[model samples]
Target: MSCCHAASWLSCARLVQRADALRIIRRVPMPGYDVSFLITAQHLAGPGARQQLVDWLVGFVMECDAEINGLKLDINARGRAVATSLLRSLAF
Candidate 1:
């Protein structure tokens, strides 16, 4: 048995490009093992948009049969400053 962990960024395109990107790596086949996924997002439109993104992320996670152990979202951030802030907040 093997365990696989993956991380990806959710974009506004409503697509799971991460899965496609991971296809190459998943071919190895983990038998009777747990898979973990960490997904992040930045610049979600608004509450509604954020919900939509969450829904898409949930579906993507289920499709991959991976447990979402963590999430790092950087909402309403435009550049490096906001990213730094988010990272700082998470550190504490």
Candidate 2:
């Protein structure tokens, strides 16, 4: 899969078509679950002598998962703030 495609998928909760996800990442709150895979031309050949590639991928995945959870908390907090503001405005 294209790194672009993988990054795009990991960047958000919804499926995006024909857009650059890296650019989109700045705008969307990270999804509740973050999972990513980036395999370059060299990585495919790394199985022969670069076992380190596997280790790096494992670490990358863990980091993404943590980031996703953090983003979810931020999004939820923002939603609650907005709701609270709306309720206060209507309280007279």
Candidate 3:
């Protein structure tokens, strides 16, 4: 993805949060290919908040026709486990 695409994705992810705000954890460019980003929800709402965020993300990916094979989410430092699980569940 291009920088614009990454920025757009980050902006959309920010809209899903209501607390500390969304932040970009990291951005890695895959030489000549897609760029990968690690984003996190700043402050969560409740127990299911993370899952809900993930759901929104899956929808966002689908809507954008973005290949999310390397998407990473860090919900309060739970790290890649939850993200991987969610992405796998979404079959992306």
Candidate 4:
């Protein structure tokens, strides 16, 4: 599930946790619910910057065998840009 808003993202996670708890009560085997978040700067300007960033992100995720649940991009009035990614993975 991809959420454009932070509130929705958090609520979605809560719902998953609740389902997991219900499964536990019924003694059903539950899969790992591990989740990770990555936040980093996104270059807002310069030629080919966006393409380069997308390539890097795709490569990194593929190499780690990670699943992306959500992505958020924000730019402030001061021209600062940020990217946030929600990743899900099996518990180690």
Candidate 5:
């Protein structure tokens, strides 16, 4: 028997994906949520780095039951793109 509740987890994953996709095109409003984080390219420069980050992300979402509403990547001064924030509720 599975200890995890699959339905809610899948729904949350879907919501996060949809939010991220929408955020790619334009700014979106995120109400009732305040969750954000940054992941730099330097941290993901080695083998299994992406997978490790994904693992941590999954754990974070499940543990916090967070509702993500936006995702954005920004280019730094050195011309490197980095995942700046997973969700930004504030106006840009």
Candidate 6:
């Protein structure tokens, strides 16, 4: 998790291990658990931008939850299908 503040970002940026990993994270286009959003004061200057940020965050969370649930269901279904097939192939 990120503190989501500039000072915290700076301090974390200073850390050696994190800094190295961060360099890779930046260079590579891969998803990571820790995220940093650099929002400037001007971003909140207008009510529209602020609302958009909130809406986008809400969607982000919802989409993550939905994707996770879908993956779990798919895994369970595949496992059950395999078990059923194995059972049918064997003598009762």
The number of the candidate with the highest TM-score is 6
Model 3 TM-score is: 0.31
lDDT of each: 0.45, 0.49, 0.49, 0.40, 0.45, 0.54
- Give the TM-scores of the predictions, in the order they appear: 0.27, 0.46, 0.31, 0.27, 0.33, 0.57
List of clashing residue pairs for candidate 3:
1-34
Instruction: Score candidate 4 by lDDT.
Output: 0.40
Mind giving the per-residue lDDT tens digits that candidate 5 earns over 1-92? 01134434675565466435323212332444355444567557779867766766676566444322211122242234223342243436
* lDDT winner between candidates 1 and 3: 3
User: Which 10-residue span in candidate 2 carries the lowest summed lDDT?
Assistant: 17-26
lDDT of 3 by residue, 1-92 (tens): 34344546675455334212333222454466453445545424568767756765566566455433234332334666778789999994
Choose the strongest candidate by lDDT.
6
The local lDDT score (0 to 100) that residue 43 gets in candidate 3 is 28
Q: Which 10 consecutive positions of candidate 3 have the poorest summed lDDT?
A: 17-26
Write the number of the candidate with greater TM-score, choosing between 4 and 6: 6
Give candidate 6's total backbone clashes. 0
Per-candidate clash tally = 0, 0, 1, 0, 0, 0
Q: After superposition, how far is residue 30 of candidate 5 from its true place, in Å?
A: 13
lDDT of 6 by residue, 21-85 (tens): 22322333346645444456665677686776566556545644665676678789999999999
lDDT of 3 at 19: 17
- Root-mean-square deviation of every model: 16.9, 10.4, 16.8, 21.3, 19.2, 12.4
- For residue 57, what is the lDDT in candidate 1? 59
Clashing pairs in 4: none
Q: What are the per-residue Cα lDDT tens digits for candidate 1 across 20-47?
A: 4332224334666444343344425356
